[model samples]
Target: MGASNFVQEMKEVGERLLLKLQRLPQAEPVEIVAFSAIILFTATVLLLLLIACSCCCSSCCGPAARGRKSQVQPMAPR
Candidate 1:
């Protein structure tokens, strides 16, 4: 509530934060390399999946126009 009390509280909070930061374990050096490899692999897989879907859609759906003509011809002779 008072200015001194507020300043003391802030100082105590800052010290606690600094202590916690110092106590944290050091990160392993290989973590960045491993993370990069995982990201690259994921991007490659997503690109491959997009290409496959596009190929399948074009091959299977684009021929529907030709397929409808053939089906209609058989019914006309009947």
Candidate 2:
């Protein structure tokens, strides 16, 4: 008799748990939109960083860099 009562209690608890889970709301669309926005933002930031690095490196290390080099060089013998 006691064993049957325990089994019945467990079954009731399981049903309640399943009902709560079934009532939970889904968020697939929201998740997809958020993921896409994050990806786009990350890509834009990476592109901007790449462009900035290229501009700085080229202007500071290319032939044109020679123009600024003279300004920083120390004066030599007359």
Candidate 3:
């Protein structure tokens, strides 16, 4: 009997959630705009950071790009 009661309560809760989900498409417009803006801003910032890192690394590392010796040096064996 207790198990049956619990199952009925769970079914009622699930039904309520289903009703709410059905109305989800009518959410506030401002919320939709804000969410979209956040996504765009995050993507733009990540892309800019990646570009800056590549540029900085190429310049800081040895000139091995063409015909220059890298910063690495060979050690004399003792």
Candidate 4:
């Protein structure tokens, strides 16, 4: 049921997008190429920033704990 609802929503969104596109004026070849390039460049920059942020802010790459002592001492030899 959830899947069907999701599909219906997607279909509606697709229909709306198609209608919007149809209402838009046709673009020249040069304009289309320029628009595509701009979109690609923006996407590339955003993706790169996302990757950089993840690497910088990730726990695995974060700074080490300062002045924290381990509570568990080493086990005595048997």
Weakest ten-residue segment in model 1 by summed lDDT: 69-78
- 1-78 per-residue lDDT for model 1 (tens digits): 699999999999889857755654554657556655766998999999999999888877787745765433545564
Estimate, for each residue in 1-78, the C-alpha lDDT of model 2 and write its tens digit.
Answer: 999999999999889857744654454766657756866998999999999999999988888778664446777989
Query: For candidate 3, lDDT tens digit of each residue in 3-76?
Result: 99999999998897677557657868876677568668989999999999999888777476555655888999
Which of 1 and 2 is ahead in TM-score? 2
Stretches of candidate 1 above 4 Å error? 1-29, 63-78
Displacement of residue 45 (Cα, Å) in model 1 is: 0.9
What lDDT score is found at residue 2 in candidate 3?
100
Which stretches of model 4 miss by more than 4 angstroms?
1-25, 59-78
Question: Compared with the true structure, what per-residue lDDT tens digits does model 4 show for residues 1-78?
Answer: 999999999999889857755754686777667767866998999999999888877745555533344688899999
Candidate 3 clashing pairs, residues 3+ apart or interchain: none
- Model 2 misplaced regions, further than 4 Å: 1-27, 67-78
User: What TM value does model 4 have?
Assistant: 0.46
In model 3, which runs have C-alpha deviations exceeding 4 angstroms?
1-26, 62-78
lDDT winner: 3
Report the candidate with higher lDDT, 1 versus 3: 3
